[model samples]
Target: MILLLFLVSCNNGSGSEKIKAAVICTSPEAAKIGIDVLKKGGNAFDAAVAVGFAMAVAWPSAGNIGGGGFLVGRTAANEAFTIDYREKAPMLGFKDMFLDEKGEPVEDMSTYGYAASGVPGSVDGMWRFHQKYGSLPWKDLVQPAIDLAENGFEMTRDLASSLNYQAENLSKTPEAAAIFTKTGGFVIGDRLIQKNLANTLRKVAEQGRDGFYTGEVAEEIARSVEEKGGFIRLKDLEQYEAKFRDPIRFNYRGYEIISMPPPSSGGTALYAILKSFERYNPADYPYASAEYIQLFTEICRQVYADRSEFLGDPDFYEVPMQKLLSDEYISMITDQIKFADQHLTSEQVKPAKDLIAESTETTHWSIVDEKGNMVSNTTTLNGGYGAKVVAGSTGFLLNNEMDDFSIKPGVANMYGLLGNIANAIEPGKRMLSSMTPTLILKDGKPFMTVGSPGGSRIITIVAQAIIRVIDYNYSMNEAVNLARIHHQWLPDEIQFERGAMSFSVAEQLKSWGYELNRYSSYGDCHGILFKNDGNLQLGISTRSNGAAEWY
Candidate 1:
């Protein structure tokens, strides 16, 4: 169940509820900074930039200047757009790079070092959005990050937890150990500082991408990755830019769904889920009942199967995003879900156990300005601590996105999906992603802002929430907080969150040959569910210590 918890801020100074602009982020300070831009008369794009930069600090594992992501937004006139800034494979990358001595491919390289790091585009991506729609000055957008970096921001409990969790791995990398982990051990509480990072932010603020790619910051990044024997080069830094594209919008029941297109698989994978499930409504079955789980899991299985087989950057492959999401196609896929509890194997679903993952720990942000514009952006460095290769010069973490490439056709990722030839690595090819930033429209007006940060589960979680809100009568909070159950098909097991449901739901389901795994948190999702009259309601899941605020 995707749970949406709305935070209500009742003003004692004035009882009247303002027509406030709201924001949700993995970091509270980041959300505040985003709302500050809105209060300053900036548009949704500016708020996205502010929120993203702040998340890089507070939720570094997921959000990074050294990474890339996707954005889906709506203009004042309700014109929908998608920005695809996901990282690309370096010029040096090749399909055989991850293979072993026996010519067998390995998956760790995609989540590990130089060969693993993709060209970073997040900085250029956010800057492009700002250039097109920002009302606030770029310098102003960069100020909060600069101050937080140089002057220092207090470490919240969540920040402390992330620091401790990644500390050991960081110690293995010289640069990361020097800055993030103190001399004795992990930097915790109030002692952590990012002086060098402040300087890096100031450089970008003062000189834009040139400050990062061709100037001092670029030198720093090149040096660190080079020293580590990784492949990212100065040229890779100079060539990166965020690409903008049209979003793929589909009708789910009656509501419109808009999501980022490739180099993001978020849209295609999610479309499959919606199209597949339109055949059955959970309301038709008891909540958390075996029938419901079986139905949802089958929908998920089919989506992953296709994702593993055909999904890739559209620039490289012809992704039939529209046809796949078509009601006719979905009916064919979803109708296969048996009411009886059962483990649908490769033989059951056919084709494969498709898997896709970009480190499960990432950050998602959504914002809507008073101009009636909405923006949803998700960023990730891939995995906790990323490559653990912090550039000594800039105090920035590099990403591990190179893994999205299909090292060799038929090989499976950790999630268990066999790769297709289309996703194979080539010099400068962008890695495919599942980061689905989305915008929802009610009668051509921005009504709800939604997105998530769960790697491969990002598609499942975001797609499920869309179903809950538009299909069921659950409130936004209830819809988001619902006990979300996940099955990607390949694993042949349904993963459930703790407090999901009663035992009968699992026992009866288990009798049908299903393996169930329980988790505490699936992903950090932040969204704003707006009432038609413009009343703002926000939800921020605690999976990543995320928060929401109305400004």
Candidate 2:
């Protein structure tokens, strides 16, 4: 790990351009896997595939083939694109799947068992990514994960603690218990192995997407879901396909920001917040000061208000992309923030007049290869360990992403953020998400790749990283490791990372009528800052366990 002090003196784009490529991710082992791929002639896309699959083995809490996510990248050729592999509700799924006979949400129905699992798309997504842009052999990229799963890797304190925390829930599923639980419980340095997961990875390496979506593995998943009274079935697995989508592109202070689009509110919400800050340079105000916090809070309030009302799966709902992102609309929202007397209460800041309703334990990794390929990917299984049920012998936990949808319009999902009809659950429809895999370009060259793992705080964490680097001129480490603050419209409170605010700033915010709440810590953001001199500066967050590798 690069010392924080060394990172402080490193000026982005101005340092000695010795480092050529870099990978920053949530786990040291995964980061090493990514760097190894780059060393072996793989491009950023290939390394992303390797790191992604490796994370599934080494960072199981949030990474898994049974889950799904989004990927945003700027190719070596300067093309920007996104892959939407977000999990979709199965054909058997219904709008009220989580509701009991009384029409009320059954407790834990959408977040704790096979009943909560959605049709996973990660394996398919990685396969598609490899097909489209990978330079390395598919099997070669996946072999590391298979090996890790088969041979086992030493457990870290964090991994041990996470498994223990979910011991009760994980033990409920026999398959999950056999793999995740130890005689007493996992401890640091213990070797964790999953032969079943290795076998699954081998099939994927051999047959690509078909290995998981069809045949034995798929059958096992479907059968387990059915036996457990869940909605997934063989048809859902057979029909699943990850898609390539045009990334949301917008200019912010001359830097072009590209991110995931609908079905993921991340890109849209990020743009709204960044665009609102365009007129006002945040560098003028001290970082984490009362003034800066208030400004950020107001913009987030307005943007999140819009998120609850107008964002969702474009395939299912007609999101007003153009209107919501228009100059007029952005100006109006910025005006509110610019001239605000106090924080806008949730009631005062409502969604635009008539919009079609259409939005965390998550994992993120940023990779930049020597050939100028940049990939920013964020994958997740909803809450930590997701649904806590492994597909019969698949040896991976299923995602509880069903909770991501607005099961009941006007109801808050697991993240405490309310959703509306636009985000209602539907058969084969992807749920709205806050996974913002994003990229930035300066002078048409890849500049930064960033994303985070925080249920609702992802957008804010990412936005703040960009702000700190571009506006405040902080180094990549400082940009990401700095304390973060988040505000989702409903709940109407400014969430400060425990030590995020000073006593003076906290007292000042309260004086301004803002309700403040302290969260231990949220995002585990990781990124690479492409220096002007052709170096790669990694911003691996210290807030959580992660590593940055460069060569």
Candidate 3:
């Protein structure tokens, strides 16, 4: 098979400066796999499917088939769309599923073990994209992943470190333990292979979505959940389907910004942030200056407050989209950012009617083909080695995305973002997500595709990237590599990547009475910018083991 031949071939790229097609992913192997698909006469969609599956094998910490996500793409014909493959609550799930008899969240029920797993949508999602835009055979798109899983790949130091970090939890699940831990424990350079997962991928390749959502695979998932005292059933898997939705879009400084809509709070939050920022000219504030950072932080807090009060799955709840995105509303929020020396108290930035709105451990990749087709995809298992439970015999990690729901009305989820009833769990409902796979258009043509993986911070990182490129005229690399900060409203603290602000700037923010927290890194953003000259510029995060290659 062509896939096998490519698999055995040396992992080398032409590295031509004049290359047109390109792919940037959080895993080097996944990026190469995507480029291979592009090289084999596939379009951006085909390359996306290949990269999606390949990441599942090479970067299981966040990449996954047992989880779900969103895909935003612009076809060569200029049609833009978003596919919401986000995981759905199982049929047996309920608003209080995670709550104990005492009306408190049960310990670990919504974040760990079998009970946390939602009905996964990734396979169905990928298959749907292939049905619409793929040129390569479905099996061909999946073969590289099967080969990688069966034949094994060298464990990177990052993967080894991740394994060790999750070793205690992974040890609880025998299937996960066997695959992630060696006899002497996991180590860098070890040849990590998963025979069961390879077989699982083989079935998926041969049978398509049914290969995993029904028959043996489905039965195993149900049995595992039941055996572990959870509630998922085979019917949930049998009924799973990925939905196509209109991509949420807004004009930001004349650039059309496209992103996934609700069940993702990302689009609305992003739109709100960008629109609010439009009131202030970036040229007026030096980038990352204390004044600039303070203004950005204040606006972020307001936007996130709105998110907690209004964002939810439109299918299940009535999201006030028109009101939320109104020019008046944006201006109202923008007006809240006052003098740089002053900060808005949490009380001043109130949520609407006290109503509800809405991982750092996800994977995102950007792909652009020579034909003007582009894809921005963000997939996740909802935390590193999600749920710490492997479905029996499947060798895939199930997402703890149930934690994404409002287990308690005012309580925060794993990401520390609070939610209201609008985001509470319901049978067969998709939980709200922050996965913002975005594609920016210039004059109705693809200009940039970007996204990141950072729990609630995904929206902020993506928004910053857009501002860096469109407003500040930074190259794709500068946009992605620029230091970032996040303020999710409830925390009331500014979390900035170390060096994102200089010591003077940090101290200045502190002096202004803003709580500041620093981290070595925050999110991993991968992006591809299409230069007007018809060349592709790629940017992969420095905090990750990803790669950028074009040909």
Candidate 4:
């Protein structure tokens, strides 16, 4: 294990000028795995594959080897590819799963019970992306995770903290509790380790994914969930396949933004927000002032308003992709953002719902290689502990992402984001998501590598961070550490991160007629930009335990 860690830590890049390379991920273990890939002469895709699996073991709740997610990458040749491995509903799904006897939303059923899990796609997605663009073979890619799991990777402070925060929820399931608990639940600095999940990773490495999809592991998942009154079946497991799709690319002012399209409203909405911001400059007013915040929150409100009413699985819904991305609609939205002092009430939203607190179940990583390839990915299991159901002997969590759909209009989610008809529940469909993994380019060269893991706030933080770096002249790290502010539309209250916003700007926004609430933190963003000298400038947000390594 020590030898493997040493191998992962060593960086021996060669060739013309020793091309700069870096990878940003949630765990040091995962970053080390990425380094291993680079050591093996693997490109960014191969490194991403190695890090993806390693993160599954180190940051299980968000890493999601058994769940699903989205990935966008550009190859050394500058050709881009997108993989949509997001979880899908079982074919047995009923539209009324979220409705109660009185037709009111049964939120608890979707958030915590047996019916919450979706058919997983995480492994399939990683496998497919790696197979197509990676230098390492699939089995070789699985080897690192196998070693980490089999020998038991040490728990870090961040992992320990996250585990403790989820003790109550994780302890509910015997399988999860047995692994995460020792004595009185996981202590903040406890070393939580897993032999079963490691063994499972080992089996996949040697026997292939078939060892999971059609064998004993699948039985354990089905039996466990079935015992809990769930609907997961062998067919769901065997039929899982990751999808390859074209990414949405659009011009935002002078730069080009590439990101996941629909089924994910995050990138679309972010693109729209930036386009609108381009129409006006923060230079015109004091940055973070009340006036600036007023306009900022209002743009967020308008974009989320449309999301609640019209966003959904593109395959099942029209989504008006063209209409939403059109300059006309964006102009219309920007023109309506008023900074005058005022709180937007439910009455103000054409359609509305009583909102609630945000939910989390994801992690993100961004990387860039000297060869000019870039990767940004977001993976999740829908919430902490993920349906509180582990895949029995496999020790994998099932995603509750299915609850992201709107069973009824005017419904509030864990994120306080409103749900409506456009995002209605369906079988074999995906739920709306705010995992915005993005790449911004300038003059056909990589300028920024960025993304976030926050649920609904993912879009806001990424947008704000990019603006901070490119427009406000903040360094990559400063941009990420700067204070953040968010407004999720239906709630109609602006939530600001603990510090950094100018008091005068906030006061100006409040006086301009906005309702403000202060939060200890918002979504954290990580990014890297190319300096004119050709050196790499990367920043990881302090709000998260994320880190960036360059060589």
Candidate 5:
């Protein structure tokens, strides 16, 4: 299960009824499946697995068995764990795999074709999670997804629109075109079913991880990729394993922050970004004021500068975690912004320390049971309907995560995020990612579980949400509903949601030499906040076509 928990909430001074458990995700059907698992006496871990699989059937845009992501959680017993199920380059993969004979990168080769895929680890990741901490039968946990795929479900407008928008790319694969764009295009409320996906889910339910990594499923995945000029081989599939690592733990004020580690720049970048504000409390500045935006943007510039220069897969490069998160490093970052009254251009900030190194088509869910167990997971296929191609007869979309690797040093990925040799493609190497699955603990107890889907903006989006609750004492809902902003160092521009800043504030920012880019919105954030009074407050982003269900 992909679990990244962010826990922090205020009671809003109301006597809300206590909740025994909660499930929040991008799909109502998936959320219901998770609640049912809790109702069936399953723990948060079990609910997480159920929800993760159900998303594959209910929300195919980002959720998947053909992709991989990170999971971070804390058990009722106070044990913390993180599973790195990130996809890896196939064994046949090479540094220049996406480059042409002219020594230039072929954009299409790594963004929308078979060569874009990586060896998926979601199946093995969920199985590892279940085996480690789940309290229910593995088969039972996955049955809900199987049922949904087999019996079909009502198509929502968002899903239908997404399918229609991607018709051209998806049409390249006969299987995808047949399943997603049938009858010219699906309308809202149309019944959509996937017999092939249902069959694949059955194999997983019956045989656990082996069902997909071996046997017919594996053969077909490899054959399809190789036949289309991709590099995946049977050996790559058979050797794929999800590794468990210690959660990245840090104390932000009084609350304990837990998040994913290397291969995912989220945790490290988040820590750097958050710690940079230790001396300056954002609460002191009015929301979206010129002062607040300047402070926030400057800090983001410095941290993201570090992210581009020094963050990458730990197994492939030595991430300077100690130095990056060190008190000295954070102090250096904060000191720069503390004295600066104007916007700091990207060119003005560079990774202070010399080092190495990482999509927006991702999904996140949060689950918290009454027992004090909490799970926050972020999973993705690297883009909407990833690679725009389904594995032949498998009924799953493949991830274009390989593009996440820097096709060439200093080159920007699809998300407009830059990287270097530290994140270059290599045989069996995991690509760097920005998926942040986080958990917050207050006084050693579960406080909240939160996560989101926003590609490169994920780290900053998550950080902003946590700040709203922790510093401003906003309710979970308020924190999520509030407009958000992002600033990656390379672009040297600030991206704000349409309503994130007032017109005057936008003009002020521009006057201060900050380029502002506004968009409708991004990120489908879902979180469960455990209140001091023992009530659970669920928060779902208004921008999401999802729900928050609890019992």
Candidate 6:
């Protein structure tokens, strides 16, 4: 049986009726900041803005001012939209930037150091969203982040572990090393101050987008990149713009799913997977049963195969969105699943033109305000502490998002996914991404807001959560906490989270000729579900030091 997890309650000013404002973020401090914004009479958009800036301070592994991501939001009046803050390759970037004399990828060129950094869009993205939707003063939303950076916050065990894990890379850059490392190295419970970052945030609060993208901050970024042998110029920073696009909307079991569109492949892949399952009732197979797992794995494999061949930055490439999402296309693919079959060979599943394509290290937050406003955001630096390089005096890590592009066609990037021309590097192009920040609605009102950070696994994790909720009748907590499995159509293996399935189920899968891999955990999801009765429920992943706060 599923149990709904009710977070603390918040009352409207009159204290009569409960105001269902809630926030679930990757860190307690960030969540608290968001909730505080709600308490100050700000709406969900304001809370999201506050959380985005605060996460940059508290969760540096993926939450970063120097990085970029997407935001999916619904206004109190039922307006749905998306902001694409995804980072773009610098104008100097090229298809062969990562190649060597022999045309082989240069060692770590796409994943580390200055060359990996893209023109950051996080600041501009936030600014755009706030400009259109925020009710709070821009400076007010950023002040908490500035305060946290200046006075410092106690480093959590996870942050300490991440700092240590990336120590070697961090040590390579003086700016990064100075902020993360103490004489004795990073330690849990130690106060970590980012005075320089605090000053940078102050400028952003005072001057808005121009504060970060131009002037002193922009010059510092260029200097850091040039000093370390990179091509990003002040022009790249100045040209950066966060786009506002229509959110991809699809119907699943009568509920409307709103998600980020390309340059994020997440929404398309997710829609494909869910639509593939349209023919079957998940409850009939029993949750996590061998039968269900086998079917789920096959669908994942098919959807990802399509993702590699069909998805990319729409600005640069023509994505066959209508054809891919067509009922005919979904039926054609779903027909391939044979219930009695143990495995579907790659050869048996015909590839579209025989082409292939695309972090667990990212952050997500979900918020729903009292008046029915909703926001689902996923942000990243591409890798832990991103390129492990900080822009000189900026005191923030730079994103290695260039690595997200297919540096070598048909070859896997750092995330172990292959790609083709659709995602290849190009000047001024946004790299293809798998960040899926999604919102779901029932009867045209917000039902649930969900998103996670797990690189390619994000699409599957989110799809499975929705399946658990709508099909299996799991509550928000149960849906999020349920064990999960992922199959990305490559390597022909199914990776399952530890304890997600039973030993008997694994043995059964093997008997059916399937290869299985196990991991301790997968994605860290944060979610909010608005109940029919006007109450709210929240769930934060136990895998991370996240929190769910309401009121």
TM, every model: 0.93, 0.96, 0.95, 0.92, 0.96, 0.95
Per-residue lDDT over 1-551 for candidate 6, one digit per residue giving the tens place of the 0 to 100 score: 11113332332122234547888887778888998899899999999999999999989889989999999999979899999999999999999999999999999999999999998999999999999999999999999999999999988777888788778778886888899876657778998899999999999999999999999999999988988899899999998999999999999999999999999988888888888886788767788998888888888888887777677889999888887778877776777787655457765665554322128888899999888899999999988788988899999999999999989877788877778788888999999899999999999988999999898889989999888888888777767777899988886888998877899989988888888998778688877877777877676677765677775
Evaluate residue 136 in candidate 4 and report its C-alpha lDDT on the 0 to 100 scale: 72
Model 3: pairs clashing at backbone N, Cα or C within 3 Å: 308-357, 309-356, 309-357, 310-357, 359-455, 360-455
Residues 1-551, candidate 5: write the lDDT tens digits: 11112322322225444566888898889988998899889999999999999999999999899999999989889999999999999988888888889989886888888899999999999999999999999999989999999999998888888888888888887988888886677789998799999999999999999999999899999889889888888899999999998778899988899999989999998898888766686667777787887888888888888887777888888888888778888888877774324545688788785432225668998888888898999999998988989888999999999998878887788998888778888899999899999999999998878888999999988999898899888888777778999988878888898888889888887777778888778888877787767787777777856576676
Query: Which prediction has more favorable TM-score, 3 or 4?
Result: 3
**CA lDDT, every model vs. true structure:** 0.75, 0.87, 0.86, 0.75, 0.85, 0.86
lDDT of 5: 0.85
Q: Compute the lDDT of residue 210 as modeled in candidate 2.
A: 95
Evaluation by TM-score, superior candidate among 5 and 6? 5
Model 6, runs deviating above 4 Å: 1-19, 347-350, 354-358
Q: Could you tell me which 10 consecutive residues in candidate 4 have the lowest summed lDDT?
A: 1-10
What would you estimate as the lDDT of candidate 4? 0.75
Local accuracy of candidate 4 as per-residue lDDT tens digits, 1-551: 11111112122211223328888876777877786677667888888888888888888877866778888888767787788888877777877777889999775788785688888887778777876887877778778877777677666666677777877887787887888756554545455567788877776676666777768887887787788877778888888777887888888767888888888887788877888888887688556766667667777887888888777888888877777777877777776665575445435855222221124457888888778889998888878767876877787777787778876777677777787766777778878888888888888888888888777888888888888876777777777668888877867778887774677666766676667788766455677777666766666767756755556
Stretches of candidate 5 off by over 4 Å are 1-16, 338-341, 354-358
TM-score of 6: 0.95
Model 6 has how many clashing residue pairs?
A: 2
Backbone clashes, candidate 4? 11
Candidates 2 and 6 compared by TM-score, better number: 2
In candidate 5, position 228 carries an lDDT of 81
